[model samples]
Structures are given as structure tokens and as C-alpha cells.
Target: MTVKYLICGAGPTGLGAANRLMELGENSFLVLEREAYAGGLSASFTDANGFTWDVGGHVLFSHYPYFDALLADLLGDDVLTHQRVSRVRIAGGWVPYPFQNNIRHLPPEERWECVRELLPGRRPEITPANFREWFEVVFGKGIARLFMAPYNFKVWATPPELMDFRWIGERVSVVGLEQVLKNIILARDDVAWGPNNTFHFPLHGGTGEIFRRLAARLGDRVRYGDGLARLDAEKRRATTQSGEVIEYETLLSTMPLDLMVTDVLSEAPNAVREAAKSLAHNSVHVCGVGVAGLRPDPTCWMYFPEADCPFYRVTNFHNYSPNNVARPGEQMGFMAEVSSSPHKPVDKAAVMKHTVQGLVNTTLMRPGEAEKAVTAWQMDVEHGYPVPTLGRDAALAVIQPWLASHAVFSRGRFGGWKYEVGNMDHSVMQGVEWAERMLLGKPETTYGA
Candidate 1:
């Protein structure tokens, strides 16, 4: 069969493109999703025990007003606003988020160490060549060694020496020695540092609810369980796993760019394949720790730099929404994320057990509260965070243009291969912008080939 437009994957990016196409009065389009359901990585799941868990710690905060309006349209009054109350576990205590900004909360000696490295002559004078060096040059060895280095390595599962530092942006809060000392001297906590300081979530369902609603709005236009298995870009044709062949005028793919180029597309150039090889990604294991009793903690999420926890971060899912727990305000749900790659391999079987012990070790759980654990629902995602390695942009430079030349726009979290702009809002906008680019001849602002 033939269609005017064909989209691969039903995630935020694919749904965003399809929705924008409909809004632009284009209905002769179809979306093919491999998953039985929509929402992709942003999808949520309800465990056997009735506890709701998201793929990971996904909070909604958009840089685009368009995204805000879209959330309002999709979720309406069902959304809950939250001021982020995040913290870091370090030196056997909790310091506020942006660990460097709140080093004052550390023990006196530890605080002095963080400050000592930031002093006039402590930081290196050489230009940073990689993420590791960049943190050292900017944050000094004390803060880098304490939080930045270890925390980033845990989350990315890739050595910082192989990663790029330009992607830090707002994701990593940068502070000077003057400001760091000022806060420590005044005993102040800089909790409100990032754009996600205020965010939103669905009150009933997890983060996936928004996308589920969007896919429903698209109705029969979305075909689930039919994944794009093969694509002859030259002929503008796609073959789904279910053996249906679709000939499209334009193709928008939200699948991983590496897979799209190496696995799906036919007769890709050697350079493109090599560039795809250069793209590295880590796998994420999301373990939802459900407890029988509730705690009065207001902490949204906590970061773990210490090796005591197998997971890099854990979100207080129950606090995000009471409905997230089986018994609303009576139960608790903790969602922990552990990233793994060749450099940092994690035993999948031990993640949940280690995650629970991590909660206790990090003081997130009280003594003997381990027996209160009811459900340890987990989901292992093969492609989690797209590591922004030193070669990423150059690799994208090679792969993206080739795909675009073939009337194939691969745009999304992995499709774009840009972690800096790979958030939910940016992911959706990348699709929206791609649709605008295709139909209206508008320049794509969110992501570019």
C-alpha cells in the first residue's frame, strides 16, 4: 500500500509529527509503531500490585510555549505542577541539587575541600579537551572528584574522557568560586538552579499518559505492532515487520539513527555506517521499588554519586502523584535508574536487589524498611541516554544529511543524536519542526541535519 506520509515509532517525536501534520490539515498519513502501545520510552506501566511506574524519572518541563499549550490540550486539568526538590547523596549526608552550589551543606572539612580546589590557583590552566578535563578546569578537582566525575560516569555509563563537554548547557549547573564561597559562607542552599526547578506530571497516569492521549487522538492513523524493518530510501518505500510494504512521499523516523542507517536502510554508504558506529548509547534499567507504608518525604528525586547504590538516580514516584502508589497516599513507589554499557556493565538480575540496598545505604530508606518492599517491577531499555561522545556531532554531520537527502527525516532523542536537545519537549518539537520543514518549507529550529 502507499501513503502520503509514513512515520516510524509512536513515541513523543513520531506522535508530535503526526499531530502537527493533522493540525496542518494533512490526514493522508499513517504511523507504524513496534510496541503494542504508544509513548515509547516515555510510556508508563502499572504493575501487578497496582503501583504505577514510568520508564525512568521523566518530569515535564518545556522550553517551548508550544509544548506547554500542547500539554494543556492533551492532559488538560489532569496535570500536577511540582517545584523540584532534588538532592545529592554525598559524604554520608544530603546536599541540595546542583551539589556544587550547596557544598555548604557538607561537613566542614568536606566543604573546605570543595572550596580549596576552586581557589585561585587550584584549577588547571590548560584548555579542557574532554568532559573530564572540562569539569576539572571549570569546577576544580575537589568538586569534580566528589560529584561531577563520579555522578556523570554513573549516569552515562561511559568514561568522560570519551565524551564531549559542550552538551553540559543547563543540564550541568556551572558556578564560579566567588558564588560557591558566597553560598558556603552564608550557609545557603541553591536548590532552584535549573529550568526543571518547576515541572509538571500527570496526576493519574505516569508521564506516558500524555502521549497515550495523543496517540488516541490520532486514532486509527497509528498502526501498532508494525515496526519499520526495512527501508529503501531511494525508492521511498518501507517494509514493516508484519510484511506490509508502504510507499510514502515523505518518511519521518523516530527510531534510533544508528539502527535506521545500519539495520533498516538498504545500501547505506560506508561512511554513514561508520558514523553510525561512532554513535554510542547506554542501556537503562528502571527498577520500581514499591513499599507497603508511606513516608512524609517531599523529596522529588535524589542523585547517587556514591558507589553504595547501583542506580545513579532514584525518583520518589509516589510523591509525583499519589495515584502512582497502589493505595494512593498510603503506599510508596520508588523508581531507580541504572545505566549500563560496555565500559560499565551491570548485572541485570542484581539491579533491583542492589537498588533496594542502595536506598538503605543512601539513607533513602529507614532500617528494616527493606521488608516493606512489596513490588520490584523493572524495565530494561536497550537505548537509554544517547552519550554525547567527542565524535557525535561529526558523526551526525555524516549520517543526518544522507538520510534527509533520501526524503527520510530521522528526528528524535536518538534520531537526532543530540543529548543537549534530547529532552521530552525538544524531542516533540524536533518532530513538529520536521513536519513544518516538510510541509511549510520552514527551517527546523529545534534540530538540524
Candidate 2:
């Protein structure tokens, strides 16, 4: 088959591009999805016991108006608005989210330690180069040692010394000593810290319902269960796993940039392949445990930085929407995310066992609640977070030019290899912007800029 635009993967990016291309009156585009279903990582699944689980903790918030309008149109009355209630487990107690901004909640000794170091010239005098140094400089050693260093290691599974700090953007809650002290002295709780302080979620069907409805609108333009296996970039031809070959003028790939360069494309230049090798990423293991009876905590999610918990963060999945549970308010679901890389290897076989026990250790569940677990669901994603290693930007510079030269544009979380703009909103707009760049000669803004 021949087409004007060929999109690989039916994830948010691919769907966004195809939707925009069609809205722009271009019907010559086709989307290929490897899975029989859509939504990629955003997809939700129902276990044998009927509890719905997402690949990981995903909350809906937007940085783009186009995305906001699109979501409103797609979900309408099916969506539920939420005020984020998140907390962190530290120093053997619960501190509000944005741990630095609310250190007053900490025990007297630790709170004084955090305030004392930030009082004067206790921080390093040298300019910061990496994430570890950046946080230590901005937040002094006490806060960095307590929260930043350990929590980041758990989440990224890469040493902060190896990561660049530019990706911090708004993803991190940056606070100064003055404001930190003010909050502490005033007994204020700084809970609303990030863009997701106010967010939305589908009323039912977990976070994937938005995409499920979106795929319905695109109709047969999307061909599911078939995705690119190999690409002959020079010939503008792609071979699918089903043995069908497609010829296209423009290719937009949502696959991981590394795999796109080394595995599927197959004939990339040695420099590009070597560059792909330098790119780093971590895997995520999400374990959901559904227990009988209601959970008293109203927290949407909680972070774990100490060794007591195997997971970095856990979500009150049932709070996002009661429909997430089989019996709504009668049952509760805890979805926890554990990240892994070569630097931090996880025993996958023991993930669920560890996750449940961790839930008890962290006080998210009572010891007796483990026995009350009606269902436990787990999903492991090989490429979870795109690590912003020190060499990431330089590696992307090498790989992107090669792809551009071959008329293959890769843009998404993994496609762009940029964590700064890898949220659900950013991932979708990366696709839309790519479409605008192709059809209207507009420079891409989300990923390109």
C-alpha cells in the first residue's frame, strides 16, 4: 500500500498526529498499531477479578489549549475534576507533597537540620553541573540528603551525577530558603506545587478512556495489530510483522528513538547507532492491589523515599474514580510504581510480594488488609522514563539529524528522548506540532523547540 503519511504506533503521539492530519483535510495518512488495542502505555486493563489498572500512575493535566479543548470534546461529562492530594513518607511520618516546601511537618530535629544548612554558606561554592549538585546547591545538604538524592535515585534508577538538571523545568518544585522558612514558621502547608495540582480524570475506565473514545473517532484510518518491523528508509518502505510492505512519502515514528535507530531501521550509520547506545532509560513495574473495605486516606498518591517501601510512589487508584474498583466505595485499590535499570535491578518475580508488604510497611495498608486483597494486577513497561543523562542532548543531536535526513520524524516521550516535555500533554502535542510542521510548514514547538 502507498500513503502520503505513515505513522507507527497508535499511542498518544501517533493518534494526535493522525487526528490533526485528518482535521487538516488530509486523508492520505494511516496509523499502524502493534497491539490489537490502542492507548499504548495509557491503556487500562481489567484483571480476572474485575479491578481496572493502568500501566502506571497517570493523571490528566494540560499545557496546551488544543489538548484542553480536545479533551473537553472527547470526554465531556465522562470526566472528573480533581484537586491533587499527595504526600511523601519521610523521617517515619507523613510530610505533605513538595517535601522541601513543607519541612515544618517534619520532626523537630530534622526540621532544624534542613533550616540550619540553608541559613548561610554551608552549600558548595562551585557551580553546579548535574542534578545532584543542582539540588544540593538550591536546597542545601539536609533537604537534598533527606529527599532529593534518595527519591530521585528511586524514580530514575540512575545516579543524579549522571543526569543533566535542565529537565527540572516545572516537574520539580523549586523553593528558596526564605519561602521554606516562611512556610515552616507560619505553619502553612504548601500542597499545590505543580501544574497537576488541579487535574482531570475519566469518570470511568481509568485514564485510558479518553484514548479509547479517541480511537473510535479515527475509525479505520488506524490499522491495529500491525506495526513496523523493519524500515527501508531510503526506499521509503516499511515491512510489518504480518509480512505486508507499505510505501510512504513521510514517516512519523512513535517508537523509542534507540530502537528506531538501531533495531527497526536496521541500516543506520555507526555514529547514530553509537549515539543511541548512550541514551538511557528506566523500566517501570506497576503493581495494583485491590482490597475489600474503604481506605480512609484521601491522598491521590504518596511518595516513598526510604528503604521500607519497594515502590517509589503509590496511588489511591480508587480515589481517582470509584469506578476503578469493582464495588466502588466498598473496595480500595493501591497502584504502586517501581522503577528499574541496570543500576538498580529488581527481582520481577518478587515485585507483587514486595509491593504488598511495602504497602503495609508504609502504612498504606494494614497487615490484615493484605489478606483482604481481592485482586492483584501488575504490568512491567520496558521503557518507562526517558533518562536525561549528561550525554542525552548530545546523543539526540546525532540521532535526530540522521532521522531528519531520511524523512523519518520521531516525536513522543521515547521518540523525542526528552523528559522535560514527555508528559501525556506534551507527548500528544509533539504529534500535533509534527503534523503542523509537515502540512503547514510550521516549525515544531513542543519537541523541536
Candidate 3:
């Protein structure tokens, strides 16, 4: 079969392209997804015990008005708006998030140390070479050592020194020295800072519901279980695992670009393959625990920087929406995210045990409460986070342009290999922009295309 546009991966990017094509009154496109469902990493699932858990801690907050309109139209009254209540577990106490702004909660000595570092005119004047230096320069040594360094290490699963700071826009909270001093002096908390401070979520079916609805709207254009097995860029043909061959005028791939170049394209250039090796990413392990009692706190999520916990972040899934639990207002749910890479390997088999212990260690659960908590679900996503390593931009500079020359647009979280534009809204908009560029001659501003 021949198609005008043969899109790979039915995740947000692919769906975005397909949706835009339909909007333009075109039906010459096809979306192929390996999974039986859509949503990619944004997907969600319900456990055998009836508690719902996302792939990780996914919350809906968009920077684009188009995405906001699309979601508003799709979800309508089924959306639940939430005010983010996040905290950090540190020094045996809970500090309001943006840890730098809440030094008043730290011990006397530590608080004094942080204040002393933040005192007038201590800022570094040199340019930061990497994320580590950026953290120390942006936040003083006390806050960097206390939270930023270890916490970021746990999340990225790579040394801060090896990653780039360009992708830190809005993702990391930066505060002025005066604001820090004021908060410390007044003993006040500054918990609200960041785009996701107010977000929305589906009232039911977890985060995956949005994509599931999108795929449903697209109808038969999206073919699940038909994943790309091989591609012949010269012939403009793709072979699926089921042995069906397809020819396309142009291909838009949302698969991991590394796998696309090295594994799928048998004749990819050696330089592109070598550049793919320089890209770094971490795998994520999600563990969901269902407790028999109501939620203990109203907090949405908590971060852990200490070694006592195996996971970096934990989300109170039950609090995101009441319908997330099998028995609303009765049973509660918690989901923890653990990141692993070559530098930080994780034993998958022991993840459950370690996660349960981590819950107790971080005081999310009591020792006796372990008996009342059931392991609802556990999942390992091989490409959880696309790291912004020091060499990432240089590598993408080599890979993306080459693929574009081959009539392939690799765009998405892992496909584009840009963590700054890796959010759900960004991923979908990348697809829309790619389709617009292909069908309407529009230039993409999000990915700098």
C-alpha cells in the first residue's frame, strides 16, 4: 500500500500529525504504533486491584494555546483542575518545594549556612560549563549540596557535570537572592513556582484517556500492533513486523532516533550511527502501591534527594482525581518513579521490595502500614527520560538533518532528543508543526526547524 504520509509510533507526535492532516481535509496518511494502544509514555493503566497509575507522574499543563483548546474540547467537563502541592523530603523534615525559598524549615545550623551563602554579593561571575556549575552559580553551594546536586542525580541518573543546562528552562526553579533572604527572614514558604503549579488531569481513566479519545477520533487511520520492522529510504518503503510492506511519499517517525538509525535503517550512514551513540537517556521504573485507607495528606507529590529512598519522586495518585481509586475516598494510591542508567543501574527484580522500603523510609508509609499496602503495579520504561547531555545538541545537529534529508522527520521526546521540548504538549505540537511544514509550508518554531 502507498500513503502520502506514513507516520511511525502512535504516540502524541504521530497522532498530532494525523489529527492535523484530517483537519486539513486530507486522509492520505497512516499512523503505525507497536503498542495495542496510544499515548506513548503519557499513557496510563489501572491495576488488577482497580487503582489507576500513569506511566509515571504525568500531569497536564500546556504552554501552547492550540493544545489547551484541543484538550478543552476533548475532555470538557471530565477534567479535574488541581493546585500543585509538592514538597521535598530532606534533613528528616519536609520543606516546601523550591527548596531554596524554604530554608527556614531546615535545621538551625543548615539554615544559617544557606543564609550565609545567600548573603549579598556571593554570586559567581563565571559562565557555567555544565549543570553542576549552573546549580552552584544559580543557587548557592549550600542549596546545591543540600538538594539540587543529589536530587538531580537521582532524576537524571547521570552526573550533573555531564549534562547541559540549556534544557533547564522552567523545569528548575531559580530564585533571586533577595527573595531567598526575605523568605528566610519572615519564616515563610514559597511553594508555588513553575508552570505546572496549576494543572489539569482527566477525571477518569488516568492520563491515557486523552490519547485513547484522540485515536478513536482518528478511527482506522491508526493501526495498532503494526510496528516498523525495517525501512528502505531509497525506495520510500517500510516493512512491518507482520511482513506487510508500505510505500510512502514522506515518513514522520516518532520512534527513538537512535534505534531508527542504528537498528531499523540497515544502510544508515556510519556518522549518523556514531552520533546516535553520544545521546544519553535513562530508564524509569514505576511502582504503584494501593493502601486500604484514605490518603494521609493533600500533597500531590514529593521529591527525595537522600539515599534512604530508592525512588526520586513519588506522586499521590489518589489525590489527582477521586476516580483514580477503586473505592474513592476509601482507598488511596501512591506511585514512585525510579530512574536508572549505566551510571546508576537498578536491579528490576528487587525494585518492588526496595520501593516498599523506600515508602517507609521516607515516612510516606509506616512500618506496620506495609501490611496494609498492596503492590498494585510495576512497570519499566526503557526510555523514560531523554538526558540533555553536554554533547546532545552537537549529536542532534548531525542526526536530525541527515534523517530530514532522507524524507524522515523524527520528532518527539526521544525522537527529537530534546528534553526541553519533551512535554506532552510540546510533543504533540511538534507533530502538528511537522505536518504543517510538510502540507502547508510552515516553519517549526518549537524545535527550531
Candidate 4:
């Protein structure tokens, strides 16, 4: 069948496009999803123990009013609001997030060192060539060495020198020297920094609940289990793995742009294919542990900068919602995220074991508690984070325009390959804007081709 709009990968982006198309009174679109269910990486799974876990740590927060209105209409009162209480484990102590702003939590010697470097005429004046240089220039040697440098390496799985700082706007917290000194002198914790300072989660189905309800609304328009096998840009046709050919006037793909160019579009230009290669990403290993006892603290999530833990961050999943645990108030759960890439290799077979030990080492669990803790679930997402490498923009410059020339719009986290605007809200809005652009000739402000 020929479709007016063929949406690829029923994640937030595709769902947003399909939903907008329906809102515009258009019924000729179809959404194809490879997974058995919708939500893609945003999907959730209930383990054998009846504990619900998401693909990773997904929090609901929005920068768009339209997205806010849509979520309110969809979820209504069935959501749990949370004030983010996050921390970073560094220098053998717990410091409130935005570690640079709360140096008072550090040891006296460490705190003094931080202040010493921030003093007048202590910082070096140099143009930053990369993220590492930017860190050292903006945050002095002390904060950079103590937390920023090491913590970022664990998260990105790539050297800071290899990444670009363009994606760091509002994502990373930057504090002035005077404020740091005043906070250190007064012993104040500036924890709330980013857009996710306050977020929401579903009361029952995990992060995937939002997408599931969206798919239900889309109904037959969203087809599951029919993965795209190949695409002929010249013919505007897509072949599925199940031998179904779908012809479309325009293709809106939310799949990873790298995969679309390398695997799906066989006739893509060699230069475009090579540009896709320049896109870098890290794989994520999510380890969910169910503990018998209640949580020891009220922390929503904690970041580990030290090498003592295999995981970079651990979210108290049970704290997100009572429904996350099989027995609310009686059982607890921890969702740990570990990133791996060519720079950092992880042993998939030993990730669970290492995660258990990491919980103990990081004091999230007691020494003997490892034996009692149950491995509720584990997942390795091949395309976890789209890294903002130095060459990413230049590569996207080549890839996006070439695809657009063929009536294709690649939009999403991995689709656009821009981590700066790759959050859930941004991803969904990309699709919403894409549909508006296609149907009404409106400019896509979220992501420009």
C-alpha cells in the first residue's frame, strides 16, 4: 500500500509525528516499529519478580508547551512528580550535584585546593580546543581534576579531549569563582542546576507507559514487528524484513541516522556513508537489582566519579514510583547505568556481577547484601548515547541534507545525531515540527536540515 507519510521507528519522534498527523486530520500515515511493542528505547519491561524497569533512566520533563499539553492530556493525574535529589560520589564523600558549587562537602585539604586554584590570577587563559580544555579553562584545575574530568569520562566513554563542547549548553553546570568561594565559606549546597531538577514519572508502567498510551491512541497506524530491511530512496519505497513493500510520498525516520545510511539505504552516496561513520555513540548496560530491605536514603539518583564503581550512575528506581517495586515500602530497587565504547570495553557476561560488587563498593548496599540482592533485569542498549564528537556537526552537515534531498527527514536522538537537543521532549518535538514542516511548510526550528 502507498502511504502519504511513512514514519520509521515508533519511538517518541515517530509517535509525535503520527499523533500530529492525526491531529491535522490526516489519515494516510503509518508508523513501522521493529520491536514487538512501541516506545523503542523508552519502553519498559516487567521482570519475573513483577518489578517494572525502564530501558534506562528516563525522566519526564519538557521545554515545549505543546508537549506539556499533550502529556497532561494523556497522563492526566496518573503521574508522580519528583524533586530531583541527585549527588556525586567523589573524594570518598557525597557532595550534592554540581560538585563545583558544593566544595564544602569535600575534605578540608581538597576544599582548600579547589579554592586555591579559583583565587585571582590562578587560572590559565587559553582558547579551549575540546571539552577537556573547556573544563580546565572554565573550571580550574582543581574541580576539573577532582570531578568533572573523571566523571565525564565515565559517562561519555570517550576522552574529554575527543568531544565537542557545543553540546554542553545548560547541560553542564558552570559556576563563578566568587559563588564557589561563598558557598564553600557558607557551606551551602547548590544542587538544582539543570532542566530535570524537577521531573515526573508514571505511577505504574515505567517511562514506557507514556509511549504505550500514545501508541494505543495511534491504533492501527502503528505497526509493530515489521522492521525496515531496505529502502530505495529513488523509488520512495521501503522493504520490511517480513517481505512487505511500503511505498511512501515522504519518509520520516526516527531510527539512528548511522544505521539508516549504512544498513538500510544501500544506494546512499559513499561520502554520505562515510560521514555517517564519523558519528560516535556509546553502548549502555542497565543493571537492575532488587533488594529485600527499604532504601537507606532519599536520594533519587547518585553519580559515581570514582573508579570504585563499574556503573557511572545509579537511580533509586523504586523511589521513582511505588509501582516500580513488586512490594512497595517493603522492597527496594537500584537501576545502574554503565557505558561502554571503543575507548572503554565492558564484559557483558560479567556486568551483573560487577554491578552487584559496585553497589557494595559504593556503599549503596551492604557487604553481605550482594548475596541477597536479586538481579531483577539487565539490558544492553547498542545505541545508548549519541556522543558529540568533534566531527559530528560536519558529518551531520553532509548526511542530513543528502537525505532531505530524497524526501527523507531524519529526526530523533540518534536520528539527528545532536545530543544537545536529544532529550525526550526535544526528540518528540523534532517529529512534531517535521510533520508541520511537511504538511504546512513551516520551518523546523528544533532541527534544521
Candidate 5:
């Protein structure tokens, strides 16, 4: 009954790591979950009328081969591969996503302005110091003015200039002047430009289903309702809220990196605690609105860049799959995803009313139609999606290697804190790779890259 690894946090990253351990034919690990169930931010909730809501918009995209293989293994025939049809709503126009790829979607005058600005084409040769400068270089002034500037502001909840551009690999679409002009003239759709051009979803269950299957595979190795309240690192033991002490030979923490180092590593490591404290995170507020009518469209998710609405994005949750909410001839649901800042406090009353108002104003939901057809309303708050600022590397520079020395490897959406590789696939590999490194001394991609 002795465990080899004690993992904290039952989020996708935690479960993913546990799954890798199981796959290695080694079950000497006990996963500690603060929550009663699996799927940290990816988990869903059910309201009175069987309405379902994810923490926010949980889309699956993968960059690693092992992640794809494992998801296929877990979902088997239940996986529903989808072509991404995401779009952005800009000042009453429907433009193809990655606005850079579809500059032709803009009006003639706007397009002319973009081209004119590029003609001067100094194409500044300076290295991009931040996200704003980087965006301007890739998309030029006109397109940046229309979408990139405002859209990114809403999503990041910070001035883009404050964001570091190092996270930009293939995640951000970069187009040349010729490519932009060609896309405009051709009006071609390049929606599937990133790593998740065609992604998979569980047919019957929500995103949480993937973890449920992973947890099922782990069986007794996974513990629910067993919250890890404290860690006795020197003794290689973790104490739960109920005063139970579980010992392990090695620890792979998938919890947020700061919490893991500060709360779990109790040996008073020098400068580590301070570095953890220096790290910053942004919290997210997810609102789910379930309607009693057919969906407006089969679109999976829509991005809102205009400031008329408080929410930045809205997902046609029911369109992801019929089983995502209720069955056919059952009911329909919609989710509005809003992000807030620590500097800007969220007023629930105003947000709720404004969310409804914004939905109507944007014509996403018809006036009074909402009142008649509305079935239920729910909101989920997850300190979800970490912010990648310039100071991050400096902080991780001090924290990451320190934890490794203690046999604790932290990786995940916020665990290793790289937004680029923090999706379901990436988080799971964080665990698997961490375990592989522990077992076989393999290089850890979660922390390394």
C-alpha cells in the first residue's frame, strides 16, 4: 500500500500525470484532489433542468504526439473530431478568425488604409519587446487597430505592451504583407491555422469526461475528497484535511506552481518562497445561460472585441454536442465567458444584468425571447488561465529548478505557467513527462519547453 508519487491537484494536469504513471505499469502513486471530483477548471456543473456548463470555454488542442495518442486511448470511439469554425464579432461585422488571415473581410476603405500603412513599410527591424509591439509588426497598424488591439485587451485583461511575446510560437498567426493582401483578395478561410486545426470532443460527456476516464483507469490510485492541506516534504509525506498522512518516494505536483512551493514545500527553502510570492495570476469569471429554444447557429465559440459587452467570448455550448447539454428535442444552452482583473473588481449584480443586456444588444439573444425560453442560469469562477508577463521568466528561473532538487516537478496550465501549452493535452503530458523524467530521467517538456 505504499505509493511512489504523491500528486496534488485533481485538475487536468494532475489527472494527466497520474494517467501516465498508470500507463507506465506503475501504480505507486496517490493523487490528492482538493475538490470532491475530477477536472479542476474543466469540470462541468448541472442546474435544475439538466443544463450543463463548463468552467469556461474548454477547447481541446494538442501539440505533442503522446497527448494525441493518450486522448485517443481514453476516448476511443467516443471522440468527436471537429473543424474549428470560430469567428470574431467586430463593430457589427462577422470577420474570419485570426483577423490577420482574413483582412479582406474588412470594408474596402479599411482594407485600403491597411495596405497604405504597410506601403510605407519601414517594417521596424527592432526586436519585439512585448505583445503589443509584436502584434503591430505582424498585422500592421490598420488590422491591429480594428481587432488585435481591442480583442487582446479584453482577453488578457492587461495592456498588451505589458505582455511578453516569448510565448508566441505558432499560437499567434503571423502573416506577411503579400499574404495579408492575398488573403484579402482571395477571401479564403484560414480558421484552422494553429495546432488545433481539427480537435476532438467527447460525444456524450463534457470535457470532464476525459478526466473521468483517466481517473477510472487509475482506479484506487486516485483519491477524491482527499484535499492536500499540508505537505511534510522532508519526510516525503503529505497530510490531508482529515489529518491523514500519506508518504511517497517522489512528488510530482501539478497544482499552481506558487501554491505548490509555498504551501507544500515546508522545509523553508531560501528565496523560493519569495519567488513564488512574486508570481502573479489572473482570475476568470464564467457565466452560463441556458435557453429553451434552438441554437442561433452551430458555431462553437464567438469572440467579442467590441466594448459594448462585458463578456469577451461566448460559446454555443450545445453545438459542441447534443449531449453537452441535454438531448435532441430537450433544451438549448449558451455560455458567456468574462475575464476580470485584480485591479478591476467584478460586480456580480451589474455583470449579470449587463451580460443579459449585452447578449440582447449584440442580437445573440432576442429581446424578451430570453425571458420566455430561458430554462436556467449558472456562473463558475475559476482563477483560470495564467497571465504570461515579462517577469514570469525571472520568477520561474528561481522557482522551477529549486522544486526539482526536492523531487517535486510542477507542470500544468498554471503549474508550469505557460499559456501556449496549457490546454488539456499539454497539461496531461506535464504529468506524464514529469513521471517519465522521475522514472527514467527523460527531459521534461512541461518545464523545459
Candidate 6:
């Protein structure tokens, strides 16, 4: 008998698994996507003027050999690889990124203050019990106090002390203590580390094109706009919003963890459910402001760790591809990524108004040039980055195993709730690995390995 499989959530992970199964002559699989599109949060939208913005700022950076192989297989030479050039905007200065490694760029008196704080004699011995502690240990009080602390607070929307650091690894590059001291004295800039040191982007399409290509390859096996409303784990079945019942021998879910635990399981394990409750997340509002003129800066993306700008980062979308927006000489656009919270009502109009104002404030757009060159503006909000808090590990420990026992594989940015493995490459490989585990009985490498 052929093994029957049901893959929920047609995001990258689900598609990865489905694609893998197909590759291995094991094609007994069905893909269900809630959204009308296939990319999940990685999806992009095009406005009336043809300005395209991803759900949030997304870059194609892969860590696995399989990822490179798969992407090469899919897009082939259509992919354009670019070197990562990044910097942190702090205290009205464009500090070289990996801020801890470039402390020498600071002014003399301020540099003295930072160095004085890091003095071996002056450094205090404190057991770093949280993320903040771990960060300070590597960066010291000077760098952490100046940028790490406040910037992290804004990004995570919680104190770093409330977060666990086990997921740090290669996700966040740490400056060598010796190099920090050497750079401080010599004033050198180090830009070698970080995951995206050398990354690739699609030449003619957005990141979603990767998914669309996958879905296209799947053909009729992939279904879209069919959201999962509820599930009966005991019956190994799920009900879509369209009231269609999908039964399967095994279920691979790439949906949010909270939805699975609370809505699917009978009585949903309280400990597991509550741990998910403790997990916090931030929403991303991606604004695509188009101008009918030449492109802006040549940079791929710029970081804003400062409070002067509302956006944490800005990607020159037009830079990614001239085709990402209107025709050449017809005008191009830029994407501003502003994070928001459900706790506070996001003023959509204000977001646009201030976003344009912010462009001028940051010299992203020259005075009066914006009005003349600007043709139209668009905004899209996606439940973006997952907040890694202290409670995550404990909650995941309870929730993950419970789903696994039921043969339900939960994976993806929101599904797995792991910030470290939340990127496009990671999430896609997760789905691929999930299929290998189920079909080929391979070991899981995403969360466990």
C-alpha cells in the first residue's frame, strides 16, 4: 500500500517536504496553504504602481549544502549572489556593523568611556544568567550599554535578561575579546563574520519566487487559499476553513505552534499551551514607497539600531532587482520595514506619512525630491519576527514532543518558534529534512541536530 501523507501549510517547509517526497519517487502527498499565495510570510505583494514589498525584509542566506544544491537546482543561473555590506545606525553615526568589533570609530572621549568600562580591573564578575548577560560578557558593559541593550529591547520588545542564549551560535556573530581590544586601539573594522557574509538573491523575482517555483513544480498537488481551521489529532484529521476534512496517515504542520496545541489537541496540554502563551512575537509593517526616477543608494539593506528612525531596517528593494518595481526610467522604489505591536494600534496613515518623512530625515530621500519623484506608496503588515524569550525553551520542550508523538511535525518561523532557524533557507531545509525523517526515516537536523 502506498503511504498517504498530508502536509499542512504550503509555506517553504511544507513545499520542501513535498518537493523532496516527489524527488524520491514517493509522490503520495498533498499540500494545503491557507493563504492565496505559497510563500507564507516570505510572500511579496505588488502595488498598483508595481512596487513590490516582501512581508518583511527577507534575504536569501543559506547555511546548509543541501540548501545551496536545492536552490541551484531550482533557479540555476537565475540567482544573483551578492556580498553582504551592512552597518549599524547608532547615536547619529553609521557605526561599522558588529559594533563591538569597531569601537575605535567612536570619538576619543566616548571611546575612553567605553574602554574605561571594559578595563580588566574595572570589569565586574557577574554570572550572566540571560541573553543580556551573555551579550555583555562578549561585548562588555561599554558596547552593550550603548547599543546592544536598547536596540535589542526595541527589536525583541523585551529585556534580554528574559531570553535564553542557547540559540546564539552562528546566528549572531560575537567579537573576539582580543580583537575587540586590538580594534579599539588600532580602530579597525571587521566584517568577516555574520551568516550573510556572502548571500544570494533571485535575479528576476522576489524570495517568494522560490516558493512559487516549488509550488509550480508540485502542480496540482499543492492547494492554496485553504486555511486550516481546526484539527482532530486523535482521528489524524484536520478541517479546513472551507469545511473540508483532510485525513492522513501522517500530518506535517508548518502552522503556528499555539494554533496546533490549542485548536487541534483535545484539552490541549495545559503546560504545552501555556508555554506557547509565554512566547511573544512582533508584527512587521513593510512599506513600499515608489518614485518615478533613478534608484536610491546602491546598498542592499541598511540597519537602524538608532531611535531616530522608526524602521529597524530599510532594504533598497529596487537594488535587489530593477525588475522588482516599475520599468527602468519609469521609476523604482524602496522598502521600509517598521516593527509594530498588537498591544498598540498601528496608525496606518501615520505609518505612511512618517515613513515618507523618515526617508527625508535619514537622507534616504532628498528634500522636495520625494514629492516630485514619488508616484505611489503601499504598505503590508505580516506577523513577522518571533521574540525569543526566557520561557521559549521550556515551552518548546513541552509542545514539540507532544506534537511529535501524534505524528504532527510543527516547523517554520512561527511553527517552530525558533528565531535562529527562522530564515527562508532554514525553514525550507526544515521541511526537506522533515520529509526525509518521515519517508526515509532520517534524523531531524533542524531543531535537534
Tell me the TM-score of each prediction against the true structure.
0.99, 0.99, 0.98, 0.98, 0.93, 0.93
lDDT of the structure predicted as candidate 3: 0.90
lDDT of 2: 0.92
Candidate 6 off by > 4 Å: 1-3, 184-187, 264-266, 329-332, 342-346, 373-382
**What's the lDDT for residue 426 in model 4?**
92
Worst window of 10 by summed lDDT in candidate 3: 117-126
Off by over 4 Å in 1: none
Worst 10 residues of 2 by lDDT: 117-126
Better of 2 and 3 by lDDT: 2
Span of 10 residues, lowest total lDDT, candidate 5:
373-382
For candidate 1, the TM-score is: 0.99
Please state the error at residue 209 of candidate 3 in Å: 0.3
Ranking 3 against 6 by TM-score, winner: 3
Model 6, backbone clash pairs (residues 3+ apart or across chains), number: 0
**Worst window of 10 by summed lDDT in candidate 4:** 368-377
Please give the RMSD of candidate 1 to the true structure: 0.9
**Which regions in candidate 4 have their CA more than 4 angstroms from the true location?**
none
TM-score of 4: 0.98
In candidate 6 the C-alpha lDDT for residue 34 amounts to 79
lDDT of 2 by residue, 31-94 (tens): 9999998898888988989899988999999989999999999989988899999999998899
Candidate 6 clash pair list: none
Computed on alpha carbons, the lDDT of every model, listed in order, comes to 0.92, 0.92, 0.90, 0.90, 0.76, 0.76
lDDT of 4 by residue, 117-157 (tens): 87778777888989999988888898888988888899999
